[model samples]
Target: MSVPVLLVVEDDRALSAMLAELFEGEGYRVDTVYDGQQGMHRGLTGGYDAIIVDRGLPVMDGADLVALLRSKGVTTPALILTARGSVEDRVEGLDAGAQDYLLKPFEVPELLARVRALLRRIDNAATVVVAGPLRLDRVTRRVSGETPDRAEVELSEREAALLGTLMAAPKRVFSRAQLLASVFDGAESAGAVDLYVHYLRRKLGKQVIRTVHGTGYRFGME
Candidate 1:
């Protein structure tokens, strides 16, 4: 059985360590990245059960990344983190396609609850699912097509998180900040939404998400 893994994308060293400890205590294997580019790569390759992303990464900004991921067909559940937690900020994050958003300086209990909710959302089968040209299994973390038994696509925790997020929303847009809190917990993860979006596109395949042209993005559309 594959132990559920999680990827943490944050720049603050102290905060990242603290989050790592928290997740570890919660029985999740953790992978850490400092910048948006690194986070994107990890999200693309690391097979994690979930992803926690920040809004202010180094290589790429978080907003663009979220949009990118939705553009691809990766339906991972993502939580966005943002220091600027104003209504507009929150709207921006949601517009990019995040499942939820968390403001900075939050309590651990709420964080844990949010995590639980995200997992529940990810596992909600009665809920609608949206994907194109690929076979995907969330519980087994298996994605394949072609043979109806073989052709599979592997994804890291972050990628998986994004997949779940898109699956939950279908066609809504979520901005970078929303993705960070909903996905990464806003400690330092939301900043890389853009890079993650790019990573998602590469993995889920092209034309999965359509760009909003100067805004965020939308998934499962014509």
Candidate 2:
């Protein structure tokens, strides 16, 4: 599995570095930005597994940043950090779209625990995976484009499993052997990987999956 990517949008340089070190030590790929504007830019395109943002941020408020992300259909889990612990402040942050809130001067262990909880919740609740214009509903085994008039296409069991495996770790290249083991359970030959790739491309469009030459394939919706 690919390392989980995390975005830290904290203005304090020291704190950001500490967060980076902390999460990286825990096996996550961490990216840090010092302001809300940069946070918004990264949040929109980063494909991060989770985000940590300070409530008070420069250029744009962290709450506003989270709100904008939700408006754009970016459902990556978020945890808001703030010194403000008032009920109203907490409510505002939660209302804006953060899944969890942590006050400043928190214990490191508690912070880690909260982030783990957020990740677990997201993992359990993610029945639909959205990549750019395409939305894959795992429950229904169907894929659909964003346009209102676009029809949803049902996928075969193996096809859906293959697509879900790739979508789960977007941008990570998966070789035929890896895919065959994970999706085909080593029952199918490596060539079957290419055959199913053809099947998916035929149903979803040529751009649905990108071949990476000798490496393998990665999600291609971008």
Best by lDDT: 2
Stretches of candidate 1 exceeding 4 Å from the true structure: 123-222
For model 2, the run of ten residues with the poorest summed lDDT? 121-130
In candidate 1, position 216 carries an lDDT of 61
Kindly report which residue stretches of model 2 are placed more than 4 angstroms away from their true locations once superposed. Answer: 123-222
Tell me the lDDT of model 1 at 207. 57
Q: What would you estimate as the lDDT of candidate 1?
A: 0.65
- CA displacement after TM-score superposition, residue 102 of candidate 2 (Å): 0.3
